[model samples]
Target: MSSAQSSMQLSNVSDPLRVHVPPNETPEERKRRIAAEKKAKKISEAIDKQLKAERDEMEKTRGTKLLLLGSSESGKTTVLKQLKIIHGKGLENEREQYRHIVHLNVLTAIKALAKGFEVNNLTLENSENDEHLAAILSLSSIKESLNRQSLSLQAAVGGLKSADDATAILLANYESVKAVWSDSAVQKYFESANDIGLQDSAKYFLDNVDRLAQENYLPTDEDILQARIRTLGVTEHKFDINSTTYKIYDVGGHRSQRQYWAPYFDDVNAIIFMAAVSAFDQPLEEDLRINRMRDSLDLFNTICNHPLFKNTSIILFLNKIDILKKKLNRLQLKTYFKEYQGANDFQSVTKFFRREFLSRNKVVDKNVYVHFTHATDTTQMRVIVASVNDMIQRENLKASGLI
Candidate 1:
């Protein structure tokens, strides 16, 4: 064979067995060629080694990551708190932190009730309630001023101090709060507090005013779960279950805060989407023109059909079932959701919402597991969490071809 033909044949051979030598090469040139080949091989091996190390590191650090998403007041944070109580370290260390929040919840409830009375043009049952209303309103004004000032100062001062002062004021006028809340006219508005933008926890706090007014009260786990605070940014919580580390990300659910959600979507194993089923009669806190339930359905549809989350498991939490149960007797589901033709019972309403959410999955064959949950119920949440854990693990195994 000719020299060119031989060289081509040698080049096509496998790397380990192949040797390329020019037909008319000098001894010195041959030595240099060998040295060059040795150096190229070493560099290639080094690159392979580095890439393997990186892969190993990624595998070692990889864990199950769950993203919690929803509209405002949809119980996303409460679910997170429940996980902390059940699977992770309990909330004993954060009792004091929650104490102030719980106290603030009481004040917020009273203020909301006081405002509700005016909005509905209702009068107090007794003239004595006028003095009580004045005290509550005065305290509320002070709190609002402190809040505005704190915002102007970028919250550097007077935030926590204002909460503390409000708590003290609440304790001082404990009887007044009780008296105003007990007024028959105020109760009428309180019954429709959701329509007037009251927090879901207001009733719980208002009902427990006597216990909350105590000097040395620390919040119970249930109390902590009932507390409502708008999540401003993203929060990461880590816990271990069954020898697997779990990283749960709770991002703000407000429309403005949703811009921060995309970064967490890339590597998520599952998403727990919360929706307050009880909010059918309520409007969005951000935009009063839109009904809260309608907003949730639209948001869920977007997330459920997003291309990036095609392979990610979605766990839909129809949260606040307790509130829905209470509201059904007072507010008609068909009033807000005109398309809801089903009867206005808990089963019909919950199933209707569940179908609405599931129908949002435009992706072919995508399954969304639905759960009707009261996030503040610790026992019920424990069972749901376990079921979610098992489902995620099964999905992960299927993805890895290990099942």
Candidate 2:
């Protein structure tokens, strides 16, 4: 026996599970023992090799990862949803699920619009008297009426065919409702939407109530684009471009959910930070006192200076530019942000914010790509997203010395 083997045996002599290798005289026994040891060593080496190969392959195929980051309701999830609609494979089957969300979205928008007018003390006036809008949107009455209609619709259809049966009743008096929305007083009150959580697509959904109420209604691209669902946790999606696989990670922007973002920071190729342009006049739903834009700016600063993301490329998406365009004409940017000394037009607001974002970026030797986006504009999004993908790919290639 070799000295090492003898020492091993001696050390394990007192152990109950120790294997006994006898110092026998027979050459046949020695030969069989060596063969057994050789076979076991070869098997272990093969297993180690196979495990190493698998780890290597996993590292290689994880490919380039992109992360979506923003403050709550800043449209990060909307951008991710857009990516899924645009680049996802086999997503046609997911349309039915999104249809229900669209129905719910329209319902939610109506409730918000009514609430906006109500909370701001705005009234819809007829020649008779000053009619408080809240009286029309009273939750107790609407809930009871909606329940009755939804039950009836479900019973006749043998199931809940449409998500919102209340849409029909809401549509019946649509013209009057629209007139209230068009009122200058109500539009002025809409600037305080931070407290109201008003949807920008309120008019669009209210106008399309008839089409949306149809039993066989399939969601249109516009419907899907305008729909909003608060993301609760991180969701990952994968797709291929030019035969190169890419993984995109989306995380919730709510303060409670931000704790879960650290795990996804490693190996990210680019960070798409979305800030809602229209939110300049709004307040955060979570904290009524905090301005939504200020919250977004703080989050942006944190991400730009984060040690884990030091090498990562940053892309800025100033979303909801369409809403900003309309709001800019009526609501002065200086009303909310006193620092703004320029004209209250779309161009001025966008340019100022663009410069604002650029100045906030602290990353050295990196240019932050800024895009003015309207999340619901799919045609424009298709072009913007393609440009974004190309930028990310080029950055990745350059990093890997492949350019």
- Model 1: number of clashes? 0
What residue runs in model 1 are displaced by over 4 Å at the alpha carbon? 1-60, 140-162
Best by lDDT: 1
- Which 10-residue window of candidate 2 scores lowest in summed lDDT? 144-153
RMSD of each: 7.9, 11.7
lDDT of 1 by residue, 96-188 (tens): 777777777777678767866765677888998899998887774345522210111112124446546656777888998899988888887
Q: How many angstroms is residue 185 displaced in model 2 relative to the true structure, after the best TM-score fit? A: 7.6
Residue pair clashes in candidate 1 = none
Q: After superposition, how far is residue 135 of candidate 1 from its true place, in Å?
A: 1.0
Error of 2 at 65 (Å): 0.8
lDDT per model vs. reference? 0.81, 0.70
